[model samples]
Every structure is written in C-alpha cells, then in structure tokens.
Target: MGTIDFDGLAAALAVHGLIPRGGIDFAKGETAPPGPSGASARAVLLVGHAGSSIWPHFQAWRATQPAGLADPLDAWSRQVIGAVAVRFGARAVSPSDQPWLPFQAWAMRAEGLRPSPLGLLMHPVWGLWHAFRGALLFDNALERPRNPDSLHHPCDACIGKPCLKACPVAAHAGGGFDYPACLGHVRSPSGSACASGGCLDRRACPVGTEYRYEPAQQAFHMAAFASPSIASAPTSGG
Candidate 1:
C-alpha cells in the first residue's frame, strides 16, 4: 500500500469544509478500545456547524427526498468519512454509535492535554457546539505528535448559564439534563415550538452562541428527532 500522508488528507478535508478545527491521533485502544479490532489507523471527526444557517440546507434536502430513506444527514456523513478513509488508508465509525468519550480519552492521551471551555483538550474550536460526524481509524502509523494545548473555555466565565436556564421544561438544570422530560416536551403534541424551530435551551448556550441553527435547519433536525427512527434510537448527551 502507498504511504498515507495525514497532512495532505487534513488539508484536503479543510478545503472541502468538513472539519472545522480538530486534530488527528492514534487511538491505541486507550480511548477507542477493543484493541483496534482490526480497524484502520487514523480517525477523522466532522463537527457540524452550531449555527442557524445549517437548517435551510437540511430542510431543502429533506423536502426533495422520499420518506423513510436513511437520514439524509447520515448519508452526507458517510460521504465525508469515506473520503477521509479512502485518502488516508483508514476505517470509519459514526459518533451516534461510538459517542465522544472514548475519542476524547484517546485525544487527551495522544496530545497530553486537558479540556478547555471553547476547545476541549480532545476537541478544540467546537466547544460543546461540535458533534462528531464520523471517525476514521488507520492501520498505518504516522509521525505527528498530539496537538498543542489550548487554554480557553468560553463557558468558564459565562454568567447566568443561559443553557441551563433556557429550557422551557427546565431540562438542563442542576448539572444533569433530563432527557426523557426534554424529549417528551419536544415530542409532545403541544410542543409546536420544536417543530416550528428548535430547542430554546441548546440555542441559549452562551458558548458558541453564534452557531445557532437557522429556523429551517432547526425544523429539519426537529423533524428527525420526532421521527420514529431517531426517537427510538438510543439517547446520548445533548
């Protein structure tokens, strides 16, 4: 097999506007366990935009499609992850399945860093606004070290904690978010606000406040949330 040029792959992804600001690392099973499980060598994360503009595009796409198709977003996600895997000789996985904890652990170990408010040690630039679109694991080793440390968490100094208080249902209070309650509210027949727009609480997060989803995007995602597939899928952090 030809040598994998990680720097080149990173540059290509950036050019395509998939990755915002994150780094690459060797998981080594410390963070992503199962001892590599015969997977690829590198992982790539596509953190979605946390602003209003993302909605219109989503709505337009969904409107043109037939019902019960795999979530369009999942298809888009696969294209991105596949591109990275093909370019870097790696394998990919979805965050909806693996979640962020293991990846965060691997990143911290690889980079020798900790979490920041705006940029967690594991994921920088996205703060909580970021969600992993997918990851790529490679079978070959590269020469890059862990990313450098960042010392800022925008939420560190945020007063009022708007994200905690913005929930109309009080779902995010007391350091624990009430999922069933929040989901219930969103899915409730009376909750037209979610269908019309999106979650008030998530938009209220002071950190990355600029990244709120546009109304159309909000509707699209809300539609997905209300879909039986997503509603029945296992839950994760908000």
Candidate 2:
C-alpha cells in the first residue's frame, strides 16, 4: 500500500536487459495474476525486452553457468526478475510456470497489442521482435502506463503479408500454426536457414526491422520452440 518508484525499478531491470513493458490494475476490472500467499495481485507490471537487447546479457550469464543448462533463458529470467521483485516487495512469475499464467492476455491489455500472423503479439514498433519474460505482482494498484503508439494494428495496413509466404513448409498458412510441420522442418536438413537465421516468416515482417533479433538470438528461440522437452530437464546451477 505504498507508492511504487516505478522509474527506479525500470532502471534496475535495464541492467539485466529487461524493460517494464506496461501494467494493469485489478481495480480497473483487469484479471489479476496469482499473487503470493494465495492472494490476488492488485497490479502487475510486465518485464520483457525488445530485439536482441537481452542477448548479450543472456550470453554473458550463460557463459558463467555450467554447460548444457536446460532452459537457460527461463532460468536467467526467473533469477533476474525474481530478485527485482523481492527488492520491490513484489512477487515474480514467469511464462514457463505451471498452470500457465495469462501472459499474452496481460500483454495485450497492458500494451494494447494485437496478435500477428506468427501468433506472437504484434507491436507497431517492435513487431514480432519483443517478448514478455516475466511479471511483477504488487499488493496495491499501480497506475497503468500509457502506450506511446496510437496507430491502429500494423498488420491491418500490411499489403503483402509476406510473413505468411516466407515459410517453406507453409507452416503458418491458413490462419493457424502447424506446430508439427514447423518442428519437423526445423529439425531436418532443409531447416538450416530457419535453424541458423531464425523463423523466415518472422524475419519477413517489415515492421520493426531495425529491432529484429540477431541470428544467435533467433537460433536460440527457434531451438526452444523446436524442442520444448528441453525445458523440463534439470537446470544447471547458475
């Protein structure tokens, strides 16, 4: 029940390549994220990064950890974000947690985002280059941050929708993702381009081209998407 020094918190997160994407107040009729002690969170602030902002930070942390760590990104996210939450007297939760938190819904509400052809929330500026890694849940309502962009959804104005065509297997065609097809392609010999450079469909998006993730970052995510069971493996110590 104290005013949040949100700016200070943002600065702290930035050191670890995280940004405060936005927030929602439960008092405003928004669904609350599960809070500590079985209570409902009064407010939730999303923590994430745009483009390859977190890549270097991630790589640096990865270097310090034991080899072959499972779900290194998730571990790093929980480690960094959880510490920030504790420092701010808040509870931190991740997208990978059990019972599945509503991160996508929370993201759309917080940033006024719409889904893209690739199923990731499309940002006018970051396009498909951003992600919500975790969230900070507070006991008191916090003011919602204003979205800087006012333009309607970017996909509405897209003429070619090249993202639909860039995939060789057309895994994203027909308004649905062919997860099995996508996984097959990424693991096969023909998947080298996607395996090394990232998803062709995602890279084809003209929006937020400047913020596109580097190949290493892209490859990392693609690996995770292709082999999800890796996440369940025991994580190496940080």
Number of colliding residue pairs in model 2: 0
Candidate that would win on TM-score: 2
Give TM-scores for every candidate, taking all chains together and pairing residue i with residue i: 0.71, 0.91
lDDT of 2 by residue, 83-187 (tens): 998888899998877767888877777778888877778888888888888899988878655554334689999999999999999999978989789889999
In every candidate, how many clashes are there?
22, 0
Write down the RMSD of all candidates, one decimal each: 4.7, 3.9
At residue 136, candidate 1 shows an lDDT of: 58
TM-score of model 2 relative to the true fold? 0.91
Error of 2 at 135 (Å): 0.3
Model 1 ranges off by over 4 Å: 1-3, 14-16, 27-66, 98-101, 104-127, 231-238
